[model samples]
Target: MSTQTQTETIVLQPTPHTEANTNENESTQDQSPPEVKWMYPKILSAGLSFFVAGVNDGSLGSILPYVIRSYDISTDMVAVLYGTTFFGWLVAALTNSTMTQYLDLGPILCLGAAIQILAHVLRVWLPPFGLFAVTFFLASLGQAYNDTHANTFVASLHGAHRYLGFIHAMYMAGCLVGPFVATGVASANVDSKWYLFYVFPLGVGIANLALVGASFRDRMASALTSSRRRERRERNASGGALKEIKETLSISGVWLLSWMVEYLVNVRDGDVKQMGYVPAGFYGGAFLGRLLLAEPTHRFGERRMIFIYAVLCLGLQLIFWLVPNIITEAVAVSLLGLFMGPFFATGISVGTKIFPPELQSSAIAFVFVFGQIGGSVFPALTGIIATRVGVQVLQPMLVGLIGASGLSWLILPKDAELHRD
Candidate 1:
């Protein structure tokens, strides 16, 4: 934030008009760099936050096989794990607005990183099955906090679409790196010690905490210290929390991402080393998609472009399922990731334009919460259903999701109507 704005806000009385002006100023003030050049550090810290989130999410699919075997558990256990993750997000969703009303970015973000580090600490020791499932709750709670705040901040910037894409692509980059590291660590032994893979993200999460501390050092103690400001805060918390959940769905790569590697390995009978590369490929495609597609998505307009991309994704998913050749399926899945990648960032960009300024931050938080709900719920459902039938169910289920994704975009405003809002 600019010095003048900070100074002004620090001195302002808790009056209604003054509060409104402060909130409005915050929308553009953070983007307008202060003479000391603080924005880059904060932006870099935000990117690192996404990378941490990506590693946590991306590694899950790769390590899943080992988890199932090592625990001697059924896919039902995975469902329970997802259920725990669901509650983590649920808790964050319920409390995030209240937390934001009282705390500033520094405290909330630091708290999130600390919680996630705790989750990883629990996992690295190879804890009991029940405890292991509970770790996801902690992880998701941390992720919801980080994801909502970082996304809202970036989306408020000058070139928001580009920055949004960059941070999200950082997530895909983490997703890309996660599987390679996870597979290597998990497969190194005759008996797979998959829990050891978490040390990497744990270390990274520590750095994220430190980076956030350094970046937001200016605002660390500048929270809402006055009890009189309560009424003003209630308005801020009301709706701004809703927009965040839409953007977080990219984390676990939806239903197909969780199962893609297993599908290649189990269904196609490909070697682990070879087939394990598929999720990485999907993330790589997604990485390029966010980097390459954001501008076109902006220029051609989000609603139409995303709809076209969704249609293309559905076709690619069909190709992935129907083609008998493993190479063909592999290529199809990656392309699907590429097309699907733009959806998360683009959705955030749209929400910022449409939402009132006061509610934007909390709105973004709520969006993350809803996506967390979806990300956990559907995959958990898939895990339960897979136990009944098989992982081959991914093909039809994924195709339906892609189609529904296309239809969902229709509900967003048309390109011409966007700026008018």
Candidate 2:
């Protein structure tokens, strides 16, 4: 039974833009689908999942200090909790390449949301340390599915690079809001501040489930062709999971980008926010970056803007490291955030331009997985060093990482093409 039906299919990532649909008559040269209605609402709905994830992840990180205090845990032990989520992301990336082959958005998203709710509830119970890590991993498992699938779905509907800003910005908006809400709840002297966080996932899950159920009717179908089917059947004998992973890792660019993100978070973040003002500044900058600067940045030039951003980030890091005053440091930190805010989303756009649609998911996931590795590995290393060299010196070391990101971007294969439109 050959499932093969010959038709040329082009898969678009972030968003789909086709030459057939391009209109020369339109004055504005926007590549987006013209005369489309209802699409915006659907995009927003899909982005809401990222929003939920942002809040959940951000709030947890914001109040982690409290969690540590309450549990009387050491920094090393607490770092494990952070590392656990990274491992979850890594596993999800590896698994998703195969998982996307068999699953549809509706069921997988619903299941992910349910798992998140369960993880939140389990966290409130204050289980043992190992149990806590397991629960976090469970939540991350859901997050990975939701995040990757949502991006893929949205990309299928529209030009992914153009609209990815809106999606990522919404996520950043949630990240900004989560801390505010969590802090407010935690301040009320209520034994249940953490409990309030669960309310979001619960309500969101119910709504998302309904939304997905209705929308699945028009969604794209994933059907394997006979050739692909044969490939899969033989995949087991052809080196199996090990082969799959090796093939994925063989993509040099993905590993390079991933390592870049890893360096940024693990190494640079310490310097950026050693005094706690960096997140506030960065998120604010991110809000403006996505909301205000994203289009112009993309329209005029994405690659040039990125280069400029990297240079500015390097300077900001120097200021944050050298300036002794809290006020001055805060100012520099905020400015740094403004420039650095657009890095990931812009990079995503660049990637969408580089990779074909069919390979987009794996490419996106590959970079993210590497970023997570950096996220997990560097932070733990910093913690170990912080004990001996003191946390203050970690700031200068962080500057080095930010510089590394810039250097990596310079070495990118097609830096010249990045500025094309």
- Among these predictions, the greatest TM-score belongs to 1
Q: For residues 1-421, could you state the per-residue lDDT of candidate 2 as single tens digits?
A: 1101100011112223221123535553664534333466556666777777767655654455446556776555656765677777666655653544444445666666667767776765556768877776877777766666666555444455556777877766766676566655554564635445556655665666566555543443354445444433342222211212212121111111112212333444533113222344555666667767677777767656666877887898688667665567657756776776676666666665555444554454444444545555666565566556644545655676676666655544554455443
Off by over 4 Å in 2: 1-38, 156-158, 190-198, 205-210, 220-278, 413-416, 419-421
Best by lDDT: 1
Candidate 1 deviant stretches above 4 angstroms: 1-37, 225-228, 236-255, 415-421
Query: How many residue pairs clash in each candidate at the backbone level?
Result: 16, 8
TM-score of 2: 0.74
Model 2 clash pairs are: 11-357, 14-155, 14-160, 15-158, 15-159, 15-160, 16-158, 16-159
lDDT of 1: 0.74
